[model samples]
Target: MILDILMTFGSARKNEDDCQFNGYLEDYLQLLDNREEHLQVLFQKVVEKYPNARICVGLRFAINKEVVSNQIIGYKDAFKLEGKALIRSL
Candidate 1:
């Protein structure tokens, strides 16, 4: 079974956009903090459940640890970012 955790990242993006639209910079940053924590925990859970699970970093975020470089999944066609443009936009 293939598990797509990208949806979780998508939701966080949406939330950040909404917070920014409402002129809530603090709220957006706080949302990012929560998301970072969640992603860290989620990654741990995934690794525990699927010892050999493959993770695709479709979106970039900090998870406080190094992910196995060899397990990188490519999404060049789906996501194209120049430098830190995506993060700067947020």
Candidate 2:
């Protein structure tokens, strides 16, 4: 089976409070899982929470110990596509 992972990273907005930012991150972390359903949920949540945040998503997979990876920046740009299409494009 091919395992897919979603990694989210970003900085808090200037006017944002640290507690709030940390809470958001904690929520994001809790939402992570190695399933398409979780990924779709994450996509929607991130879009709603961090519309202008600079987010990067990295995808990695291994084939015979050889790892292949790709990363995309800009939350809006990456999320423009839905579900599997987003993963494919990234």
Candidate 3:
């Protein structure tokens, strides 16, 4: 769904000529950031049930490096994902 929304935004002819799409994308990312806490709860439950499971989560238009990097890295560490295993999961 996230990828589909990003692809739709990218493919729209209006977005090519208008800079407003950038703002829309930024807003969308912000919405994701806001909703992440609820997602984290679900993730924690899954990890608790499957202690050795490796998981990877990604966003299509993750423009904020600090937020995205911190979240993914946190997931990696908390989930005990390492090296080749992490890459393979991706």
Q: Provide the overall lDDT of each model, using Cα atoms, as 2-decimal numbers.
A: 0.40, 0.38, 0.38
Better of 1 and 2 by lDDT: 1
Cand. 3 Cα-lDDT: 0.38
Q: Write the per-residue lDDT of candidate 3 for residues 1-90, one digit (tens) a residue.
A: 654443443312243421123223223333345557775566556656765443222212323334556646555443443322321112
Q: What TM-score fits each model?
A: 0.27, 0.22, 0.26
Task: Kindly list the per-residue Cα lDDT of model 1 for residues 1-90, writing each as its tens digit.
Answer: 234443333333455421122222333333345548865566566656765654333344432224534445553322354432333232
For TM-score, candidate 2 versus 3, the one ahead is 3
Look at candidate 1 and tell me the lDDT of residue 69: 48
Measured with C-alpha atoms, the lDDT of residue 65 in candidate 2 is: 16
Model 2: per-residue lDDT, tens digit, 22-46? 2233344544666756665766677
Ranking by TM-score: 1, 3, 2
Clashes of 2: 0
Stretches of candidate 2 exceeding 4 Å from the true structure: 1-35, 59-90
Residue pairs with backbone atoms closer than 3 Å in model 3 (clashes): none
User: Number of the top candidate by TM-score?
Assistant: 1
The predictions' CA RMSDs to the true structure, in order, are: 14.9, 14.8, 16.8
